[model samples]
Target: MPSPNALRRGRRLSSALALGITAIVATTPAATAGSDGRFGWPLQPRPAVLRHFDKPAQNWLPGHRGVDLAGAEGQTVLAAGDGIVVFAGTVADKPVVSIEHPGGLRTTYEPVRAEIPVGRRVGRGTRIGTLESGHPGCATACLHWGARVEGDRRRNREYLDPLGLLRLTPLRLKPVRP
Candidate 1:
């Protein structure tokens, strides 16, 4: 049998290992995504943005971290980019799905019934889930989509504007000299 001191040391070592593994799993996508700049709108044909991302002054303060897009109830929600499903479940009575893109960015859809499972790899435009009925943020049927860069620490996680990642070409004015 191992000595008492040895047992204590073993337990500590095990705890450390567990923590390390958990951290790696949680932050793996960020490292995998790199800076490819390949992302698109989560909603196909790009639904109208009912509301834009308004970052909160502080993490816990009042702010809309994601955009609320106009969508029909039961409409399919697509993955914004290729990545693995990190989370799929309900929170505060609202169903939510989160996908982790290769560049460490995680996109989220809420008021959704997830079709994918955690750890499942998905591609851009993949059907992740369907829109549900109860998003308090929206008066009518809409999908609340949010994005954030994965961080090892809670405070370090940074929320980003999903529009910035989209590949939509901006409308430019034509030169006129009549």
Candidate 2:
């Protein structure tokens, strides 16, 4: 029902749209792949998740900024990814260790006594500190893990669910049906 010229134009538009979608998918980070497991859980044995990361509607709004993993007191807390120790000190009287990874991603672990000092380069799964008890609202000792993208301004920083950084599920290949 359409003219030849209109048919060609529609095909061109569809091709351009497909190309644009492909470009976006190629550039966007794979939430589950984690770049072939570059990142991992901070707590060994994949401790139970007491609480999950809950982002606030606004940066200033109240929300759970990180996930709490049940860990035993004195348990070693490993680095989630390869990065340099940016901060290894107490935050609000609670010991914390923060690492700055590639691509401006920063991960923070609380209730951890830092074994590595600031500016030290650490690989994935490196023991950065030991977990301590007394995390608020947790019945047992837990490690609060948080992640964010470093931005120019404080409000510009975007908080992320730290769990998405790990490639826990194995990749599967599905057959394409003709």
Estimated TM-score for each candidate: 0.75, 0.77
Clashes of 1: 3
- Report the lDDT tens digits of candidate 2 across residue range 64-164: 99999999999999999999999999889999999998666789999999999999999999999999999999998999999887654565677888888
CA lDDT scores, all candidates in order: 0.81, 0.87
Q: On residues 137-158, what C-alpha lDDT tens digit does candidate 1 reach at each position?
A: 6788998888887666666787
By summed lDDT, which 10 consecutive residues of candidate 1 come out lowest? 28-37
* Model 2 poorest ten-residue lDDT run: 24-33
Q: Candidate 1: misplaced stretches above 4 Å?
A: 1-37, 173-178
